[model samples]
Each structure stands twice: as structure tokens, then as C-alpha cells.
Target: MTRLKQLRFEVFGVFFRQCTVDHARQLGLVGWVRNTEHDTVVGVAQGPEAGIADMRHWLREVGSPQSSIASAQFDETDIAELEHESFGVRRR
Candidate 1:
């Protein structure tokens, strides 16, 4: 089953967006990631359940080199198909 998950995470680091996009692409997941004004990163990721799980772990425990993860929250629901074609970075 596929899933569409709302990803809201906080990190005390840089290369956050690059790391996220790279990981998502590597997992064959599609989503957009954006930097928030409050130093938080908000985005959505859609892909297979297994891939999603791996991404979640990377976001929560492991991020870019020297990146410190604060917290990660997800609100997800199963979907019949994916809604995005590629993962990209969004501007504020």
C-alpha cells in the first residue's frame, strides 16, 4: 500500500533540504520539502510503506552530516496511488 504523509520536523542544521530530497529520491519517494520561518521544515512524502518507514527513521534519527534532529511528526493516510512524481525543494 502507498501512503501520503505530512512531514513536519525541526532540525538544528543545514543541508537539511538537500539531505531530505536526496533520501526521498533514493527511496523512490515523491514529495516537496520547504523551510519554515520558525526554523522548522515542513513537507509531504508519498511512496510505499516500507520506503516511508525508512524515510521516517532517517528524518527522526539521522539527517545530513552534522545535522541535529529536534523532533519529527507525521500525519499519514494510506492512498491508492501516489500524487507526486518527484521530490523537490520549495521556497518560502
Candidate 2:
């Protein structure tokens, strides 16, 4: 449970921002999600092992509302440490 981790997902359409917000809150994760200019949404979540797992589950099950998710890609990474702040949508 000490391994570093990170998640990157893409949601196509206009339903990403809102859905991500709710999902992150439900999972008790702390990170930020934002929309790309290419019509895709991207996000990053970092925290305890259990919390991150819950977040992944939510995204996989119901992360988008008005948008039809074309695909999702995620992987683990070596982060120095988790951030000390609230998680929410970020302007990009």
C-alpha cells in the first residue's frame, strides 16, 4: 500500500468536469481534473491506496454524465508525495 500511484483518464464530450467532481468527492480523493482543448477531459488523483482505489472504481463505473467516454487510461507513478489541499476541477 506504499507504492506510488497516479491515474490519467480521458472523457469525450461535455460531461467530464461535473462527473469528476462528484466522483472524487465520493471517493475521498484529493487531486484536480481539467478539460483539454482537444475535447477531452483529463485528471489526476493521489492519496492513500484505498482512497485511490475507490476513486478508480467510481470513474470506471459512472464518471461521465452527458459525455460518452471513448476510452480511459491509467497507471501508477512515483510521486514525491501527495499534495496537501482540497481536490476539485482546475482551469486549464
Candidate 3:
């Protein structure tokens, strides 16, 4: 848990914003997720390397039960500490 990372991601599909928030929190990540005007779910997740990897898999493969995920994109960076204090959903 010493290694931390930050990743910005966009997930295409529906009913994924809250799902993302729950998953991120479960992974002990700290970041925010929101729905875009384009109807995509977008957010940043920062946490341990392993948790990040798990989250990546979840976002890319397994999302909300009702969601029909078409695709996902991610841009990651190495970080020394978390930029967010907790994982959540944002209005913006």
C-alpha cells in the first residue's frame, strides 16, 4: 500500500457513475466520479497500485449490473500521495 497512483478514466454506458463510486470506495481509493454531458462516466481514482489495477479491471469489464459498457479509456500517473481524501460522486 506504499505505492500510490492516480488515474483519469472515462467509461461509456449507463448507470455506472454510482457504481464507480461504490467500487472505488470499496477499493479504498480516494477520488471523484461524475456523469458527463455525453452520458459517459468520468472520474479520477487515486490509491494503492493493486487497488488501482483492480479498479481498472472493474471499470473496464465489470460495472453496474444494468450497465452496458461499450468501452473505457484510462490515463494513469504515478503519485506520491492521494489528491482526494475520499472516493465519491461529484455534480460536476
| Each model's lDDT | 0.78, 0.70, 0.91
Q: Report the C-alpha lDDT of model 2 over 7-86, residue by residue, as the tens digit.
A: 66665554668778777777666788898998877888877677677777666665665666666667756566777466
* Per-residue accuracy of model 3 over 2-35 as CA lDDT, tens digit each: 8899989998876778888888998999999999
**Rank by TM-score (best first):** 3, 1, 2
Cα lDDT tens digits, model 1, 1-92, are 34454444444444488889999899989989988887777788888888888888898888889677767777767777777789999999
Clashing pairs in 1: none
Alpha-carbon runs more than 4 Å astray in model 2: 1-4, 78-80
Best by lDDT: 3
How high a TM-score does candidate 2 get?
0.75
RMSD of each: 2.4, 2.5, 1.0
Worst 10 residues of 3 by lDDT: 13-22
Highest TM-score, which number? 3
Candidate 3 residue runs with Cα over 4 Å from true position: none
Instruction: Give TM-scores for every candidate, taking all chains together and pairing residue i with residue i.
Output: 0.84, 0.75, 0.95
Candidate 1 weakest lDDT stretch, 10 residues: 1-10
Which of candidates 2 and 3 reaches a greater TM-score? 3
